[model samples]
Target: MLTINNLHARIEEKEILRGINLEIKPGEVHAIMGPNGSGKSTLASVLAGREDYEVTEGSVTFNGKDLLDLAPEKRAAEGIFLAFQYPVEIPGVTTINFLKTAINEIRKYNGQEPLDAAQFLKRMREKAKLVKIDDALLKRSLNEGFSGGEKKRNEIFQMAMLEPTLGLLDETDSGLDIDALRIVAEGVNQLRDGKRSFVVVTHYQRLLDYIVPDFVHVLYKGRIVKSGTKELALELEEKGYDWIKNEVDALEIA
Candidate 1:
């Protein structure tokens, strides 16, 4: 559902992503793994239309429309959901209110009538139960004083509420415990159907054990150096990224 071609992005005159080319189809899950400063997160931010990054070249097309040409909110309305590594804390906004605002905003953008309060609350309770998010937690201020695991679960809860066509999960497993990870992964898995896709960006392979990406891509120095199935993730976890880097360097030199 998403196609990126020769993508180049920079922040404050410093380049991050260089010639990133990836194509994601519906119902497919792709995992991007790389060490620090390898531009994995940068790719996610650029794709989500974060204003700080400047796209110098390349084009991203989502569902036959030019994605880069749209604003960030417009991108969300087009069915892109990005789960940030650090979810922001809005002290005055309850989680339910924040989510309701987001859902209504998206609906307005998509030309759909806004959900009534009763309908919205009904859907909220159902999705919250689906993600196993406690009703007590949803009543609190958004991410305010929440534990790391709670924040992560809240992110997945939001995802379940929005039901975006494409989900970009960036470092979702970073601060999650095993229990939280499983819950989040279950939420993601439940949403995986023929009409949705996911790009999971992470450094370690542990998250892949639960998500089981259809494709695993090794990103290095701003580009994907290798792409394979879930087996590649296992091999990387066993042999480390240095081995993959050496192999890639050898192939380039050959």
Candidate 2:
């Protein structure tokens, strides 16, 4: 569903993503594991078309279209959903209202009619129940005064509602406790239909325990240094990243 080739991106003068290449097929989930400052989140932002990071080289194709050529909203309309590491708080905008507007906007983009209030409410209730989010929470301002877990759950709720073809989760596990992590993961798992794909960026393997990626990739120095099955995540958890670092450093020196 997504193909990234030799992707290099930079924020101003400092380069982050050096050469990221990966293919995400339909129905596959790929976990990107890396130490701090390894450009894991950068890759997600680049794919989401965040303006700060300019793509220096390479191309990203999503369903045969040039992904990099599209704007951020365009990317979303094209079925890309990015769950931020830290979801922003928008005061004065109720979660329900915000999502209704977003959903209608996406529908308009696709030349479809917007959902009326009753239709929207039904869909909202279904998604909220699927994610186990409280109705009171959605009535309040978006992420305003919500706990870390609530914010993450809200992100998953958004993803569920959008039904994106590809989901890019950037450190969704960060700051989440075990209960919150499981809830979020379960919500994500529910959305894993046979045709949707996901790229989960995380530093630890705990998230993988629940999400259960089909492929695990170790990213270092902005490139994918190793790729394997879920066993790779277990290996990283057991041995840590220093061994991988040593191996990559030795190859560079040689």
Candidate 3:
């Protein structure tokens, strides 16, 4: 569903992603793990077409199209959903209204008819149930006065509503409690079918325990330094990233 080749990205004059190459098929879940400054989140941002990072050299193809050539909204319309680590709050916009607008805009971009009020509300309630979001919570302003866990759950809720073909969860587990994490994971798991894919970026292995990625990749210094199965995450949890860092440093010296 996604192909990335020699992906080099930079912010301002400083480089972040040196060269990242990853290929993911439909229904496969890939977990990207690395320590601080390893460019895990940078890869997610670049893929999602964040304007701050400029792609110096590389190509990302999504569903046979040039993904890097598209704008952020275009990427979303192309079925890419990015779950932010820190979800922002719009004090004046209610959750339902925000989602209705976003869903309609994406539908319009995809050349589909917009959902009517009843259709949209029914879909919203169904998706909210999947994420365990309360009706009262949805009535409030978007993420306004919500707890950290609530914000993360709302992100997953948005993902559920969008039904994107490819989901890019950027540190969705950050600041989430065990309960909230499990709820969000459940929602993601429910959406995991043969036609969807996910790239989960995280610093720790705890989140992988719930998500259970098909592949685990170690991103270091803006490149995927190591790739392995789910067991790799367990090993990282046991051994930490120092082992990977030492191996890279040793290779550099050699």
Candidate 3's residue-wise lDDT over 76-107, tens digit each?
99999999988898999999999999999999
Error of 2 at 81 (Å): 0.3
Per-residue lDDT of 1-254 in model 2, one digit per residue for the tens? 89999999999999999989999999999999989999999999999988999899999999999999999988999999999999999999999989988898899999999999999889898999877999999999999999999999999999998889999999999999989999999999999988999999999999999999999999999899999999999999999999999999999999
RMSD to true structure for each model, in Å? 1.3, 0.7, 0.8
Worst 10 residues of 3 by lDDT: 203-212
Worst 10 residues of 2 by lDDT: 122-131
Residue 44 error for model 2, in Å?
0.6
Task: Give stretches of model 2 more than 4 Å off.
Answer: none
Better of 1 and 3 by lDDT: 3
lDDT agreement of model 1 with the native = 0.91
Question: Candidate 2 at 97: error in angstroms?
Answer: 1.0
Cα error, candidate 1, residue 98 (Å): 1.0
Better of 1 and 2 by TM-score: 2
| Candidate 3 global TM-score | 0.98
Residue 243's C-alpha lDDT in candidate 2? 97
